[model samples]
Target: KSKNPPFMQWTDEKIAALAPNDSTERRGRTLASSAKWNTIATNYEAIWGECKGSGSQPYLVQIKLSGPKYKCSCPVRKPPCKHVLGLFFLFAKSSAVFKYQAPTEALKNWLDQQSTSTVSSASKTLAPVLKTEEAIEQAKLAKQKRWAQRVQLMTSGMDELELWLTDLIRQGIANTDIQKASFWNQVAAKMVDAKLPRISTYLKETHLLIQQNQNWSEVVVARLGALYLWAESFKKRNLLSAEMQEELYQSLGKIIKKADILAQHPSSKDLWFVLGKKEGVDIEGRSFRKIWLQGQKTKQQALILDYAFGSMGYEQQYIVGDLLDGALVYYSKAYPQRAIFESFESAKIYEKTTLNTYKDLNSMLTSYGKALVQNPWLFSFPVGLSNLKAFVNDKKELQIKDVKDRIIPLSNLKEAIIWKILAISGGHSVSLFGEWSGLHFEPLSMLTEDGILSFT
Candidate 1:
């Protein structure tokens, strides 16, 4: 039985074409051809590590890719083990049509060589390779031209924006909002999305001035960049950058003033932003504008922003550098739904040295103190928040004492690491949920009484 429904368009020829042996362009084809590679192309299953003789299972494992790519759980870590070698040999020796296709560029080059170099000596002088010096010059010019165009295009939208932003700072934001609050907010949001940290300074000062002095002008003009992007999004929702799409949609929920519902809604399902993702060449093809969603939060529902590639729209499976800044994510699902995003690399670092291993009440309290810095809701579990006898910080993490192997509360320790990161990142400021909502494990907010009690 096949895991794939009867292949609607799958043909034996197609399956043969995806043969793994030809996928590589190793120079020693004849030598490799000698190996009897025995392989079967079926629906790819998971990569399972198997050890035939133990010791430490052989270094190699078979990995199923689509259908053709396979790894042999042999003594090598590389792919297509001897099993693949044998499979290729068997296929070539047999009458079956299975054969591998070389990658596009390699195949093209090989074809060109076959046409020219393999021709009778008479044609060698007919089409000589382009002169290396000439090729280099052409390549350089092409690169220079491409960069010039990119710089020109990316900065083209900022002309009016720079002047407008400067004006907003001079006049102030809060005061300008009197005419249109949404406009000003939009600009502020865009600047943040653009990774223009300094510009945000201007927006903040303008906001403060508006609040304190009520002075505003060019508010709408200043915010034009972000608003225009959003308006365009409303007009062509799918065309907007990934970061912009998330920001604008989430913005609808957070807008102090709601847009009329009559406006067409973005009818796409939620795409989970799994941290650390890599897409083939989109990030490479476009050098500017990346989509970026913000750092993890206490509330799970925080809006996401797309980063233009090169500008941060670059996607990866995990946020690699500066763990605190942003996450690597992409849409993983659809429909009005709960999208799952991971913070594995950034958040998983704390999994070691847990307070559960601590023997003293003082140390347990200390661990809770650390947890409070990253999260304010860790009042129980490994601390004594759930038990009646420990730390007095209004009920926090629960801890058990080893005395007589009895359960107990952790004493309140002041040195919590969670509190440290929170203070550094800007302490979580909202409750994130209803008092009685009963849900625990909300990553972005203060943990609740029941949450602490549950962990205990």
Candidate 2:
């Protein structure tokens, strides 16, 4: 919003990037071609317009060409709205339509406010970094008070869960109606009320697991045991190391602020390879995508997780099989895998480094075991196995045999899928990267001299 000089010209691609999807872009393009405008004006720093929509009056639309901030009179939840998008498309496609003029009064007021706020914020940010001793003490006291409240809530929740588990154990999970959704919902609701929504989610998932499996009692008991361990550990959290404490807080669903993370954590710059990516939606319906990268020099794996809500676009950069030079700020965790880009230097579709792979399944398991020792919360870890031959076993199950002839029966993989990897390998031992559960390896991609073949 600050009136900086126009850094770059707006293009069709840039307009498309602001749009949520191709459909939105198409609609905007169509509207741009036909929409009637009362006034279209622009300066170097911003553009403003009054466009006739399907309404009585024209909608006033203004966009700061610097931050690309949009303000429109239309009542659309999406920033910029369709009207603004149309305006952008018009500006990008043909700018001569806009008259060279000074900004309107409303646009001028907004720009002036933005400039004042930017100057004030700059002055504040340039102030001293350290707080006074008295201020520090007050902040520490407030933090302690908040933590104490959280601990009390968790304790209450744990007590209720302990009693519920006891009742189930005595009644027997087989006797209990695990298929009854209300039964789990009641307990999950209690957990939510106690401010432990993540635990509620775990309980709901456990109910589904019991219903899906034939051995419902075993699954129930095992999950209940894990819950008990978490509860007991929470009671003795003071004895745990700092890293374990951070892990415990994460497991409890405590949110970590991104600002704090970037401020406190160390950053590293390296040439990173885009290994793989996964996309999923959370319970709240927020769409998220996670891209995994491994550094060539540091040999460190970093995860870039991004989120978007309705009508918002995901990140377009960081394509798989590309190498990028960037400084990444890691989140404080036992494994330290998740990170955000602090600074990106350069990126290109280049693949030069050799993929690190284990010689055998035992070696892979050993590495996972070591990682688990440092971070017990890790349920799935990535591994690249070398010299792996894919074949069908006697039971018609797809299996991957390593250099030592040790076979690992693959799960979450079908015949046609294994055939693709086999076809890529041509019966030769190739480097395969995948996630390892305790039972099987879920191959994500296979690396060969030709290129990276994604199986996920």
lDDT of each: 0.32, 0.73
Q: Tens digits of per-residue lDDT for model 1 on 1-456?
A: 335321122222333323323432231133233222232232222222222233444333232222223445454433334444444333334423332322245334533443343222311234445679989899889978975664343343344455565675587545455554455556656655544333444455445434443223443343344434433444465665664544444432322111221122332222222212112232115332121222333212222222333323223222211122222222311211122222222222222111112343355456556643433211122111211121213355433223333434222223453343244324222111101101111112222322211100
Q: Which ten residues in a row have the lowest lDDT in candidate 1?
A: 433-442
Alpha carbon deviation, residue 220, candidate 2 (Å): 5.5
After superposing candidate 1 on the true structure, give the runs of residues whose Cα lies further than 4 Å from its correct spot: 1-131, 152-159, 176-456
**Candidate 2's C-alpha lDDT?**
0.73
CA shift at 435, candidate 1, in angstroms? 25
My TM-score estimates for the predictions, one after another, are 0.22, 0.66
RMSD of 2: 8.0
Write model 2 residue lDDT over 2-93, tens digit each, in one string.
23335545666556656654666677777685346788888867778888878889999888764356778988665646778898888888
Which number leads on TM-score? Answer: 2
Candidate with maximal lDDT: 2
What candidate 2 gets wrong by more than 4 Å, as runs, is 1-139, 166-178, 207-225, 348-351, 392-398, 404-419
